[model samples]
Target: MKQDRHVSPSVINRLPRYYRFLRDLLGRGVTRISSKELAELMNVTASQIRQDLNCFGGFGQQGYGYNVELLHKEIGSILGVDRLTPAVLIGAGNLGKTLANQVNLSTRGFRLIGAFDKSPAIIGTDLVGLTVQNIDSLEAFCRRYNPKAAIICIPKEAAAAMAGDLISWGIVGFWNFSSYDFTQNHQGVTAVNVHLGDSVMTLSYLIKHMDGFQEEAETEDDA
Candidate 1:
């Protein structure tokens, strides 16, 4: 594994994919996997797989390959899956509610300790076992829970202010889906901006290009 502090973001992004695939292998009762086999499953070259894994540390043996469970545990440790990071959710709107209900934050290292919203209709209501508190109570709640991260699901206009408030309360990271670019304004905060519309547009572009590719292939076959 590469020991350098300046690991590329692309490598960082691929770590989660490796972790997920290892998890699936574990579920299937697979005991071990070679770099070549794993690479085939992930659709990457074996050398690339080795390079990415080397960024952390070598886990595989020369001929024995990697012990599936051990490698999975090591990758999970690297990814901080066991950190149980406390997090708060701002905005108890549709997206926020869906995330709370459907997503298992703990599986990914985060624990949802508080959920807040400005709307009186949402505030004081139960959201997936946690009561939605008034936005006015965010600071107090943050102080009490001491969350390390905040999940922003509010409108674009309100996201920045909400992020500022969370930052004041000692939040160091944000998972933002508000269509606002938090990192552009916040200099030192670790923010993951989720743009659903952009992802859908990308899918549309791929579908259009795929159709064009199929037409060209068919024409060549006809010739």
Candidate 2:
């Protein structure tokens, strides 16, 4: 299936989830599935599944449903999982090391080409297979490898300058673990600032104010 330039962000965001479910289906040896069946598994409407897939192009036939393996492959292609774009990490802290070792880089379409840090202790350490290099080597390394993306795992105070340096080095995409917000002035840059703290706070809110929790507690006490 061919990608459309003007697809909605919501649809774009759901592509990975769709890709994951399809991959699971393929693993289960399922050969084909109707939109309704896929939607049920995804907790969405059948029409929604059809509409989202139709954004790229028609992949289903009248009576044949969708070929599980082929659909999974095509969705992965659309998500750029086959691209393997070169990527680098700037901060070799605990979170950085964790991401390096745990995250499936190939499935996400990135190849970790380099890792860098300013601390003397971390500079020589091994993160997965990549050696943690001195921060001084970052610009030169980026120039050599021409990494298109960067994973920022530094503190908020230093994120701005780091972003500037990366932009100058021709890095256009960022997976920022810091809280810094990169807005309009970034030009052609595409950044996803992942605030782990904010996510925890969101979970806190969900637990503290969850619907029917208070009533359930009262009923339990009475029981």
Candidate 3:
């Protein structure tokens, strides 16, 4: 396993894409693939693919390229997909229910041990086979299950206090959808904050600029 911590975050981010493509290739009975071929499939340059993989000690041979199955396994190991990480969800709202039902958490190395909510109405409800527990029981539940990660789907106003509570109960990682900056509030916490509104805004910006780019291209072609 590549244990280098010096790898850039950009390179780290690209590893999952490499893993996914490799897995798909393996599924399609592709035994080996050259960097150029993989790059073409991923819409990236061959040199960029080589550079990203090199950060974790590139597996491709000069003539043989990379073994699809082996590369998938290596990237999986790097991403800790083989390890089952216990996690708990901290809300039972519409978004939370959707995530619980739709996300294949176990396939991606996480197991949702508990789902929680403050409302009595939602407390006893079933969410993806796990019974929704009251928020008051969070501390005891965490102590019992000893989950390493917390999935925060509560409102932004309630996020900080819940995060602090989870951190006190030994949760080290957070998948935050509450739009609260957990990392900023708590130093050394591993957090991935998902802001759906921000993502939509970003996509809207890209689409607007891409239309402008196409118009410019058309004008240049006419000229």
Candidate 4:
């Protein structure tokens, strides 16, 4: 299906969660799902699901519901999750090591081709089955592996420099864990900032609101 070229970025963000849920439903032998079911699962209104689906071309009916397998495939293709993406991680610091150990890279369509660090002691060590290569090997790895993107886990001070280094070596996209504002010299490169503090603050707001809700519910029960 030919998708509309001008879909909103918010819609794009919702695709991954929708795709994951649809994939799960399919795996559980679910053939069809109502928009209401999706909306409840995703914490949105049924109309919202239907509208988003319609933005990418319709997938559901008024009463019969949507075909789970078809929705999964469409979302996968739209988000580029259907294809494998080669990636690398730089800086073997605490945060870097944490990210490395947290996920099994073999699943999830991400191939961790290599890791780099400036520490001489850590160089040549093994991390997540890939040997830790020195920062000097960055260009070589980019040439050999030709990864689509890289994760910058180095300190804030080193972020810009490492990003430039990656850019020099043909890394077109970056998942920047370092809190640095990047100035892109190349037209194709994209840098996504992953601010840990902002995420924590968001979680804190949720916790506070949930506590308030519980207090209100207790008062209502007393009444």
Candidate 5:
């Protein structure tokens, strides 16, 4: 199915969550589900689910709900989850090690073909089955594998230079965990800047306001 170019970014952002939920459904032997059922599971409204899926050329039926496997596959396809784009991690530090090892990169759209770091002590060490090559060897490795994506976990100071190097070296997609924002300069490239601190701070805000939010909702219902 062709993608809707006019789809909102908010809808696009929800695709991964939809894909994940559908995958879970498939794993649990759920062969079919209605929009209402799905919404209940996802903490959303049935109409919202219908609108979002419809934006992608609605695969559901009026009476039969959605075929779970088909919906999963379609959402996965839409997000390129199964593309297995060749990817590399640029930092072999604590965060990098966790991501490369703990995360199932292949199942989540990337294949971590290489890991790199600037430290001499870390060089030649094993990281998620790949040897930690010195950052100097990055270009040579890129030439050999021609990776389309890179996972940047290095420090903020190094991210700017690394982003330029990746773009010039033909890497088009980035999963950046550095404290730097790489999206500002790269106009056409696909970049997701993962600010770990920002996320935690945002979580703090939600936690701080949760009680008030629930009280407001309760008051609204009573009114």
Candidate 6:
């Protein structure tokens, strides 16, 4: 049955939010939930949820709602959050240390099991609960621990070399925080570039548009 079930990336992205909402509803002792309720919580149309779920085969009745417990289990299993995904960090700088400290990764199926760095000063230091092992140990660490994913926050100049090493060590998924372009190794790994400057620019654009919209709304409200 699991082999027959197919999930698109868009559907995969929404599963965690749905799972969290279902957990909240269950805590409130709610048994059944309508598609419209889910749509409202996720700020999407009711038909969208229906369509996404229908892709995996229909579950709810025509008038009645979905089973809260069953939906939770289904979404959890689909997103791979039911079991822990071993993860590691490949730097010990400020950005790397901050990512290492993030606790919500486990709830989303990722666990920060270890970290590495080139600095002798930072190496052997404890980052949260995980120690900052030397960079020389990277290959051995990956082979031994077999992490499902890794976060790369090394310097821009060092990122490509590190990425090459990671690929050689069988790391296919990467959350790259460096400023370098990973175009060369794009085919070999799943890389997510966290560009802080680009993110700030996006925020500024949203804030400008939002301010104009608020002004228009206030004018209409006064009229």
lDDT agreement of model 1 with the native: 0.70
What C-alpha lDDT values do all the predictions have? 0.70, 0.71, 0.70, 0.66, 0.71, 0.65
lDDT of 5 by residue, 1-223 (tens): 3347599899998997898788678868999999999999999999999989998886999899999999998887787755667778888988888777776665454667789999898899988556799999899989887877777788766776676777777776564453322232234432233455534111111111122211111111110
* CA deviation > 4 Å runs, candidate 4: 1-82, 106-108, 178-193, 196-223
Q: Which ranges of candidate 5 are over 4 A from the true structure? A: 1-82, 178-193, 199-223
Clashes of 6: 0
Over 20-67, each residue of candidate 2 has an lDDT whose tens digit, in order, gives 788678758999999989988999999999988999998898887998
Shift in Å, residue 140, candidate 1: 0.9
Error of 5 at 63 (Å): 58
Q: How accurate is candidate 3 locally (lDDT)?
A: 0.70
| Tens-digit lDDT track of model 6 for 166-213 | 656666556555332222132443222235444411111012112111
Tens-place lDDT per residue, model 1, 1-223, is: 5565677899998987888788779868999999999989989999988888787777888988889999999887877766767778888899898888876666445767789999989988988667799989888877886877777788766876565666676776665553322122134433223454544111110121121111111111110
Per-residue lDDT tens digits of candidate 3, residues 120-197?
999999887577998889899888878877677887668765656666777765654533221221443332334544
Which residues of candidate 1, in runs, are more than 4 Å off?
A: 1-82, 178-193, 199-223
Score every model by TM-score: 0.46, 0.46, 0.46, 0.44, 0.46, 0.45
Q: Which stretches of candidate 3 lie over 4 Å from their true place?
A: 1-82, 178-193, 199-223
Better of 2 and 4 by lDDT: 2
In model 4, which range of ten residues has the least summed lDDT? 200-209
RMSD of candidates 1 onward, in order = 16.4, 16.1, 16.4, 17.0, 16.2, 16.4
Q: Candidate 5: lDDT over CA atoms?
A: 0.71
Candidate 2 TM-score to native: 0.46
What TM-score would candidate 6 get against the native? 0.45
Across 1-223, the per-residue lDDT of candidate 4 in tens digits comes to 3358688888887887797688668768999989988788879998888878888787776679999998898887777753656778888777777777885543544657689998998888878656788988788778887776676787666776566666666665555453323222245332222344443111110120121111111111110
